[model samples]
Target: MKFKTLNKNSGKDKLHSNDVIADFLHEHLEEFGDPKEDILKALNYVFDRGGFILLGLENKEIVGAVVINDTGMSGYIPEHILVYIAVHHNQRGKGAGKKLMEGALKLCTGDVALHVEDNNPAKFLYEKVGFTNPYLEMRWKRKQ
Candidate 1:
């Protein structure tokens, strides 16, 4: 397996646009994208801002992908956030996801952060990669 990075100007020889990344996220993550268009827009914005979209591949087939933002507001320490990640269904339980997460963590130059669902088995993998559970996430969405 190998890891590659994509930027705003990166070619599509390996993968297409943010839409492709969003599709991968939707496949393995619940509540990933109710209206995927929103996810695509968000992804493009990240790319334009010099963020990262990393892909994990094995012999030219994508096994996993991760979205990371390395910069935030000005005057800050530029801590990175691992916002989204997923491994292909057929590729799970074989350490592809763990390798992807580990590679992303190592690629970051600053502190990295990510959120795992309470019941997500990937929590173990994240821990294995040296991530600690430091905070609880709370969310409130306006009723539709």
Candidate 2:
């Protein structure tokens, strides 16, 4: 497997067309519904702000992708957040996700953060990559 960071301007399009990302999200819509508009918006926001997108490929085919943001929080402290990640179901358990995460970490200069649902198996992967759960507050409100 090979890991590569894609150009921010083109990453979103590549991800949207990737068989792995589209198929996995479609197959698991019960868990990650087909929120195409939302996903596109998130991708655009990341790219617009000089964020990073990493891709994991094998045989030139995309197996996984991760979107990260480098929010310059302060001198010596940039907040890196993994906004989205997906690995092909067929390619799961094959270390593709780990490679993608590692690639993202290489670009982060400070604290890194990501949100995983309580039931998301990917949490284990994050932990394995040296990310620890931090005590923090999060609140959500549905748009009116």
Strongest candidate by TM-score = 1
The C-alpha stretches of model 2 lying farther than 4 A from their native spots are: 9-30, 75-78, 140-143
Clashes found in each candidate (C-alpha, N, C closer than 3 A)? 0, 0
What's each prediction's TM-score?
0.79, 0.76
lDDT (10s digit) by residue, model 2, range 34-130 = 4766555555656677576676777876677776776767455447767777887888888777877888888776777667786888889888999
Per-residue lDDT of candidate 1, residues 47-81 (tens digit): 67756778887787677888887566434433777
* Per-model C-alpha RMSD: 3.0, 3.5
The segments of candidate 1 whose C-alpha lies over 4 angstroms from its true place after superposition are: 9-14, 30-35, 73-78, 139-144
Residue 42 accuracy (lDDT) in model 1 = 53
Judged by lDDT against the true structure, how good is candidate 1? 0.73
